[model samples]
Target: MANTIYFDEAGYTGNHLMDPDQRFFAYGSVVTSDEEAKEFVESLIRRYNIQNGELKGGKLVSHHKGRKAIDEILREFHGRLLVTVSDKKYTLACKLFEYIFEPSISDINSLFYGVGFHRFIANILYMEFMARGAGAEQIFDEFQDLMRRPDDGKLGALFSASKHPDNSPVITQIREFAQYRAADIKEEVESLAESSVGKWVLDVTNSSLHSLLAHWGTKYDVITAICDNSKPLQESGEFFKIMVGNEQRLKGGFAGNEHPMTFNLSGPLEFRDSKTCHGIQLADAVAGAAVHVLGGGTDDHAKRWRELLPEMSILNILPDKDELDLRLGTARRNVVLLNELHARAKNGQDLIEGMPLLIARLTHRLNLPPIPRPVG
Candidate 1:
């Protein structure tokens, strides 16, 4: 039977608003053989221990309950919970901006290359499956079936690099940076894309966003989420609302931009719309996708490897409780953070704290090669 896959993104804030230096974006696909999709879902329900129609015990709790609920759950559960934390790498990278080293395209590429390649491959696999004759209905059916299942031991995940393709000047700056350390960084990048560690890095960076999109995309057939860093929130929201509300405008204006196989849960959700859905859920989905890939399954899988991995144990250091209140106070909070980080660098102040700790934590979590300490 032909394989079918689902695609979605997590942690993408459209305009690098949340973390300027680290633009967190993830694209994940749930791929399964048409015949196996049903069985896969059935297996997931039992494995994740969903009972009475409620997800229980393990990472499933956080996923079903929402971010605030996750924080509560983590606080209560404490030891070795199966939860996926948001990008500690991004948080750490944001801290790197204060170190006075010029950032390069490779630096950004290294971060995202680790993030996007696996999911991109997953997408490629879907294309490969489609080329073999899987119909859209089969694909959508498998995707939905997988979603309904409880968290299996696997988490479906992947990551992608985010850049303003339209902004050539910034692109040029990145390219210039690449020219200087192309050889060393390129080798590292190549290694990362192929390695399991690289795969997890991508997962940590993008899984949250991917999960949300997968959840929402599977719910609506004509999904049309955009990743633009240019538009203002109010403007973007009004535009999306008008588009979603008026099918005619979408049919006429958004025709070419639409996906080929329209399903029930394929409409667009704006990354900038706070009221639309939970950002952390989206991030978790991306993590879920990564876990799926790491665990190895046809389409959907459980978080077996993720649960065992040391990285899974590291507590996600979110914006401080006080900071969270201030940050989430406005619709444009993400954008504000991005602008603040960019602005603060000019004055040489570290915009975010706890970065070094994050890096050390992640390196240990992912089992990355130890960062070489400078010989004193």
Candidate 2:
């Protein structure tokens, strides 16, 4: 059966100097059985009052009140937020590497594949801990040993050193958490493995780019990442919109318009921009509001997805041109100019006249500074 894998990531500052341990990279995917996808579409239409005749720019109906009410409506429409699982051991280890080695962000990006592989290693360590009833510290040590001898098959040494008894309650709790986390992780991973189309979204906040490259690889049908447009700069607020655009193109299908996977990265504008706004809609808005009152994009919503699937697709339904232009003209214009300059800037020649002044004006107009650095 064909499936659509919507992915997004959370954590990991794009800045390389940032400690990886402080970052928590997450990827979440929602896989709909063919039948379920159809049902979801129908639910969306009915709940949002989406109609052929409905004007495209009208206020979309939502189940909740206030600014983010759409979150509530989406939850009421979609049933459950099925997710996949992955281990955080590698995520932790990567942070250790970053802390100890302190590689540039670009340098780490180059080792993307290795970073992802580390996460798998972490997953393996987690499993070992659960099976053998080990403490977090013991697990850490075993993980270190595995890093030294990645080829080893037998884990008898690690298991023998565990602190808890086979039937201890602590072991039970760890096992339960693992099982629960695994169910969610499996849902997301299986979607990627099974899908013939769709993209994966990732939250890069508190995460290393290496983590992503290792898991999914650098080459795919389409891979788009969303990052803070300008933090150290001036246009950070628009980062979310920029990421949405990239994800939209993937969702529309890149390549010969036939590729199966679409990858996305999202997060808070102030954070690493790895949290998927799309997944938030799915988990909290669509699933939470519809199935459980607890479902909605709150701190809990962010935390749940962050812990479960740190990477997932970020689906953004942009506002109409008129509204967007009115709200973000200067920032949008700068993005366009940045692209043009990137393509045409010869040698070290300045792309725009009075570049500093232009950026300052954009900052004044958009109320954010340090325009988003373009992805090469």
For candidate 1, give the lDDT.
0.32
lDDT tens per residue, model 2, 43-103: 5546555544121111221222221343443344333233222223434434332321222
Candidates in order: C-alpha RMSD to true structure:
22.5, 23.2
Model 1 residue 196 lDDT? 39
RMSD to native, candidate 1: 22.5
Which regions of candidate 1 are displaced past 4 Å? 1-84, 87-172, 193-201, 205-376
Tens digits of per-residue lDDT for model 1, 1-376 = 1112333333434322234343333333233332443343334445545444322222443353332233332333233123333443333332222111222223333232222221222232233223432232232232222222213311121011212233233222322222333343335444545543332332232333333333343334444443322233223333234334332211111222222112222234334321222222222343443333332424212343344334432223223323223333321232233343344444445534543454445556555555443221
What TM-score do all the candidates reach, one by one?
0.22, 0.25
Which regions of candidate 2 fall more than 4 Å away from where they truly are? 1-117, 131-241, 244-282, 285-376
Tell me the TM-score of model 1: 0.22
